[model samples]
Target: MIALKRLQILLPFVGIAVLLAVWSLTVWARIVDPVLLPSPVSTFRAMWIGMTSGKLGVDFLKTVERTIYSTAIAAIIAIPFGILLGSSEKVYRSVEFVIDFFRSTPASAMFPLFLVLFGVGDRTKISVAAFGAALVILFNVAYGVMNARKTRILAARVMGASRLRILWDVMLLESLPQTFVGLRNGVSLALVIVVVAEMFIGSTDGLGQSVFEAQQLFNMPDMYAAIFAAGALGYGLNLLFLTIERRFVHWSGK
Candidate 1:
């Protein structure tokens, strides 16, 4: 079992190494133009330079800040309302069309509307991200509540628990695992929306802007570096949520 566990840990690293090897080979063989796809060494060098110059740090921080703000806004608005909706079939049915409509709409398609409403400022970018993230979180949270075991709720009622008490003690606990899933997805969507906004919505500074500028200037290495930074940020955020979920939702599958 110990050896099996060690192999499990080593397998991912092996896969990554194989991917890198392929990437390096392609670069070496000039399968693509170096201008379009710089060698991994050049990309690493550019990343190092950006880090040393503090530019990457600033851009990374800006993107991360926007993601956090949007996610917080989404969670604050979605959770309570989602719970309320889930607890009442009438309320859920009444708003189902509205929820489904907005959820189905692509966030990018709403960019122009948000830009007009909030203007081409940070507010517009954050608002767009928050809007998208909120819908995803709301959907997950409501379903989580709705899917709570009937037996558990019946038990609570039989024990003479108030409706509110049952909601808080039984439904809420049952929903936490799915809520965390929503949170993870919501934060990812928030980051994606914010980055896209920064790239095309006239942001002065951000990882997206940095990438856009690098590409416009034909600086492939810097562009790749910025892209890598953005990917790392997303991975880090997801990992964080996964850790939180594991710790708090320990009984999720069981």
Candidate 2:
């Protein structure tokens, strides 16, 4: 298991290294124009320059702030409602309808309305992302709660466990693994949404803005750097979540 886990972690880095090597070789060979496909070295240099100037840091922080805020809001709003609706069959049946509808709705389609309402700021971006991301989280958490072991629940009831005790000790604990999975997915969606939101609404700064601006100026190296940063940030976020899951949902490993 440890060997498999190590391989799982190493494979991605190996793949990335191979890709970068191939990219550099191709660029050096002039198989692709530098303007079109920057060399890995060039991209890395651009990234270093951006970092040294603190542009990348600022943009990275802005995106992180937005993502964190949006995710927090989504989780707060989704979790309680998910628990409430999931606890009862009737509530689940009714709310499932709403969940399906909203989950199917494209966030990009609602961007215009958000811009109009919030005037093209962080709130609009965060709200739109949260709205879309929360549905997946809500449904997953609800399913987790609903599908918690019936035997355990029955045992708890027979043992005269209070409702709160059952919720805290059984339901939440039982549902945590599923909830974390949902959160992982939600964070992925949120990252995508955030980039799109920054692009559409034109934030003061972010990876999206950096990419957009670089493209306009035809700076392929810088554009690639921005994209690299975004990819690295997204990867880091997933890593952080996986670590949390491994720590808190250790029982699920069994």
Candidate 3:
């Protein structure tokens, strides 16, 4: 059992190792043009230098700021609304169509509308990302509340819990796991939107803009480095939420 657990822990690294090996082999074999597909060493070297001594670091921070801002906005608006909607199944059902409609719409499709509303500035990009993330979070939070164990709710009522009390103490706690799930997913979507928006929405600096500019300039190493940075950022965000969940929502899986 100990060995199996250890192996399971190492499983994630195995794929990473295999991927690096394959990439190195492919580069050495001249399987593709080096200009288009830089070696991992070269890519990582660019990543290091760009992050340490170049504009990439600034761009990375800009992207992080925008993503964080959008997600915060979404959560601020969605959480309370979701809770209110979810506490009453009738209310949630009445507006389910509208919620689903906006959620189903691609955020990108709203670019033109936001552009017209907020112009080609940071406001438009952040608003669009916020809009998209809100729907995702709202849905999850509502579902979380709705799915709260009925037995617990009944028990709370039997113990003389009022609707507000049950919502605050019982339903809210029950919904935490699902809420965190929404937050993680929302942040991810926010990052993606911010990146894409940066590439085309008059961005002066950001990971998205960095990648776009590098590609246009044929700076393959820089482009790959930026791409890797974005990937690392996404992975880091997800891991951060997971850690928080483990810390605060320890009863999540239970």
lDDT winner among the candidates?
3
**Candidate 1 lDDT over residue span 125-223, tens digit each:** 999999999999998999899999999999999999999999999999999999998999999999999999999999889998999988899989999
Please report the TM-score between candidate 2 and the true structure.
0.92
The reply for model 3, stretches above 4 Å from the true place, is 1-9
Q: Residue 225 in candidate 3 has what lDDT?
A: 97
- TM-scores for every candidate against the unseen true structure: 0.96, 0.92, 0.96
lDDT of each: 0.93, 0.86, 0.96
Worst 10 residues of 1 by lDDT: 49-58
Worst window of 10 by summed lDDT in candidate 3: 3-12
lDDT of 1: 0.93
What lDDT does candidate 2 reach at residue 60?
A: 82
The parts of candidate 1 lying over 4 Å away from their true place are: 1-8
Q: Model 3, range 35-151, lDDT digits (tens) per residue?
A: 899999989999999999999999999999999999999999999999999999999999999999999999999999999999999999999999999999999999999999999
Instruction: After the best TM-score superposition of candidate 1, give how far the Cα of residue 207 lies from its true spot, in angstroms.
Output: 1.3
Better of 2 and 3 by TM-score: 3
Question: What's the distance in Å from true for residue 42, model 2?
Answer: 0.8
Superposed Cα deviation of residue 200, candidate 2 (Å): 1.5
Clashing pairs in 1: none
Model 3 residue 2 CA deviation in Å: 8.3
lDDT of 2 by residue, 204-241 (tens): 79888988988989989889889989999999999999
Model 3: per-residue Cα lDDT at residue 138: 96
